[model samples]
Target: MAETEGKFDFAIDRGGTFTDVFARLPDGRERVLKLLSRDPQNYKDAPTEGIRRVLEEESGRLFPRDQPVDTALIGWIRMGTTVATNALLEREGERTALLVSASQCYPPLPFPCCWPCNNERISVGLRSHKGRKEYDLQRH
Candidate 1:
């Protein structure tokens, strides 16, 4: 069996609904865990809880919820999340703006609009048009 030089490595994927964890132990053993993203009744954070579970299983010792894990034992952890994508899909966040080169073509949106330009620097200003706030992009 391949060994990990006495360190644990973990790869995690945290989505809007579920979080998955994959761990590699020092002794070449592998573990996987899946849990709910939001389970306040059971755990405060899914990734942390998952790591705790894996460590407990390896050491055969139960770790208390309030105690911090031995991070020194872990070699590395890679994590990814879909929270931002979910927020964007649902349109549940604050108003935002994007700045790009004037020569680039961007698909028009109903609320925030952009105009075609040929200059290098574009100055953007907020204007009230027909009782609605709009973005006025002008070349500088």
Candidate 2:
């Protein structure tokens, strides 16, 4: 493994049951880690703990679990989580709705305007100023 020269880049996925981390060091080396998402006994956050562990191995130093990790060594971090999906499935979060409008003649709207991701609670509506409604959502 080549020694660290610059900052490290990390991509993380935090799921309901587990958190997975993928790191790319300055030397173009990659590392991965997976841990329980809710392990409060040993660590407060799984993603942070996973990053700390990777950094320790990359820098060959023991980072105190209580102390914050050195942000200077991190170039960037991209994270994704399933919290929204979990919340929607469990009906635990605040409801949100979005309304969008656009012209239909100038730049025609795509056919099948409704997205496949739409569910009973989500919808897409289209209305033209020409007094013609292309897609009208009926809320139940």
Stretches of candidate 2 exceeding 4 Å from the true structure: 1-5, 94-140
> For residue 55, what is the lDDT in candidate 2?
90
The residue-by-residue lDDT of candidate 2 on 22-86, one tens digit each, is 99987788998899999999999999999999999889988888999998888888999998768
Per-model TM-score versus the true fold = 0.65, 0.63
Question: For residues 88-139, what per-residue lDDT tens digits would candidate 1 score against the true structure?
Answer: 6677675556554555655543334334455568877998889878766666
Candidate 1 local distance difference test against the native: 0.80
Q: Would you list the C-alpha lDDT of every candidate in the order shown?
A: 0.80, 0.76
Candidate 1 residue 34 C-alpha distance from true site, Å: 0.7
